[model samples]
Target: MTSVGTPPAAPVTAEAPMRRLDRRMIWVDAIQMVISLIPTVVALAVFKVEPRPQVIWPAALVAVLGVVTAVNDLFRWLKTRYRVTPDRVEVRTGLLVRSNLSVPRDRIRSVESTANLKQRLAGLRVVTIGTGRHASAGEATIELNAVRRETAEELRRLLLRGADRPDDATVLAELRWRWLLYNLVNIWAFLTAMFVIWSAYWLLNNFGVELDTWVLGLADWEALGPGVTIAVATAAVGLIGVAGLVIGFVTEFWEFRLTRVRTAAGTALRTTNGLLRTREVNRDDNRLRGVHIGEPLFWRWMGAADTAVISTGLAKAGMGAEPASTILPRGPIAEALRVARLVLGGDDRPFEAPLRPHPRRALRRRVIWALNTTGALTVLLLWLDLTVEALPGGLWLAGPGVAPVAVLAAVVAYRALGHTVHGRYLVTRSGLLTRSTDALDRSAVIGWKFRQSLLQRRLNLVTVIATTAAGYGRYKAPDLDLHDGVEFADRATPDMLTPFITRIPPRR
Candidate 1:
């Protein structure tokens, strides 16, 4: 990844010419055509139909549908036009109903541009404008394809208000090849999980019946033999590994030239490998829930770091998604340092180095996790009445179990670093690799919730979660001075949400 320079200094502007997607719609329209071909081949080739009326009718119907959709798409494209003025974005489109939509600069959440397989090959990109606000109670989104690069950027500038906001801090990070190293670790983790699950099948058949379970239909009971089972499982697991490898290959191939140009519209991750897809994202500093950058000894040695967002939508159960966000292209520690700076909203000293958790909290979390995990394991043991063989051939789960304990330790070190407030600004931190945190102005929280479990109520441990368009985040503070965890609901709620308190339609 090459460090991106500042966005073009001049006011960015552009016009998009309406061009229909290629005749691919023909294939789409010919759903029946494809269905017919299967039967046609069967009847004509195998059955040797004389007139083949069965095949001809479906084929003819498909042909008609294909011709109609293709023609309709042409007119559809002609009627669609995206125009960007310095202040507003006007999207004019209509086929039968006809519609004209405009978003003020402030209304737009993010403007995205990229090329799909077709558009990329044609040297075109797709531009999507997401109006953070909803339309008639629902979120609004728009997508346009096959637009020129300059044109796309021009529109981005208009909606974002300018090509660049001189007042806003600028971050220019280059894409580095070494980033692949992080991905390799990920590949190893995934494959290891697959292999472990497969290897345990022979050993855990009885345990499944006795020990553990999830909500409903998340796990299976039937187990397999390790050797043949592993072979079959390997076929499946190997294919997935191969697929992840393929995506890795593609990311390297496509995003090899990745460069992020941060401008007023958002960030454009430019690539040269010609993947035909470029991801454009606009994030409000206010929406930041957390910024996490990790240089695990493993990754550090490989000269890579994984950074990610810890916004509102962290996760429900178990380890959540990648807070190990960016599989940052590799570079000197300075680059990793700079990336962390960006995540912390360009804070001059945003703890570029890993911050340890509070020792007390770390130990506490570990005790809790260990107790629960071991209790679960115990229950599973008793429930299954397992032989020594059931625990794992030779302690497969031990290594991973220790990892969580380490997290509890990290928590203890980081507890003191918990959510700190500077007036209305809030910042919080948690995690090692998939770690995350959320930092937002108190006023940016659209909504919040305080939840307590039956056990939590007695212990004074409660969880507070805040929600906004950026996503959701939660704070789990336990062992309050009182029987009730020192919950901040009554205070934090109104303080954080006073600004954007509006009715949001249910997620569609």
Candidate 2:
């Protein structure tokens, strides 16, 4: 077993010795494997499957696979070795096909340390070093799994160390118990619960359990009317969703804390959170371009919002994982705005600047689209009634009834469109379901793209997109006057668009 100790402060050289990961990983892997097989064992017992060759062989095969996995993990741990040098961090692994991966220390953008319940109990962490560059597969990042907690911390500081050191860290935000209430209002909670319910039904059916029959048997549909049945089902689903939201919120943000630390390189924002699965992410301040304030319709109604970073190194973090750019989770909108200000160096101008509303033609376009949809639905329903059997007496009303609602939605969507340039940031707000206000650094704008549909061309409107390296690559000001959009983009980045644009007089 490698001795887990505090790493020395000696300057690393090319000749520095490579170190092995903690040997405890082998035991952790073995235990996890055993735990995973418990479901198979339970299923066999529940089904009362005889100890015959057919059932026994498959069970034995599963056991063999688990053992093989454990052995492979053992070999991987024994063969893997890593080292830190003055200019780069390198890792070598594989037995027959040896592979060595190295990332320049200067290119390191963020360092994340994570530990699940099992790894935490084993005093280990998984350290991931990220570089903002886009590369094929695993080329841009390095993962060191099951390293000693102290060793992970040491590597983070060493790889990110700078020439100058500064003062103590400042606490930017901490978890508030009241913030958990916001989780209950999330649409994702119900969606997740429904998905889980469907998965459970599918799994039980696959296991040869008549899940549908059992569900049907639980309720007497004739005794309870359709309205009562729907109410009961809705209540049940709501209860499950609420419970899930509470559990997920507590586990993910139990001890959440965001801090601004003055590192040798510069200031960095660090977030530490989670209960059973703890995570610590350190992001360099220099990489941060701006902030994004998200306000979903439901959240906005409740005066709640979330904040995320418009920064490099986080664009790829959302691939099958929780977003790494989310600095502040769903909370009061005021708190979200406050954190955004702090992240952008206490500049309130980005959020406070009055946004310029788009041309009225934009609203007209939305209304026309909505009316077209209503017409399509109405025609379809009428066709169905004339050719097919007579519809329910009130069913035909649905088509005409949706017109007012759709038109109202169009108006709301139009109200959401706005854009402005504030200080060092170009701010844009759009979307009806989830309004996002992005304040991107003006200097980060690499180029501008003007998109116009056939209809938009007729209306003299265009969607202005500001392309940047940070956060989603581009931010759009949907449905703006064509001339105004070009001028806005030109002013935001100054000389970059000046040569390409012909100066047009402002419309009177």
Question: Model 1 over residues 395-464: C-alpha lDDT tens digits?
Answer: 5345446656655654543443344443444444554443344445455556665555555444444444
Tens-place lDDT per residue, model 2, 204-307, is: 54345766788789989779999999998888788788888899889989899998888766788888898887877778888899999988875677888878
Overall local distance difference test of candidate 2: 0.82
**lDDT value for candidate 1?**
0.48
* 10 residues in a row with least lDDT, candidate 2: 1-10
TM-score of candidate 1 on Cα atoms, chains taken together: 0.54
lDDT of each: 0.48, 0.82
Q: List the lowest-lDDT window of 10 residues for candidate 1.
A: 315-324
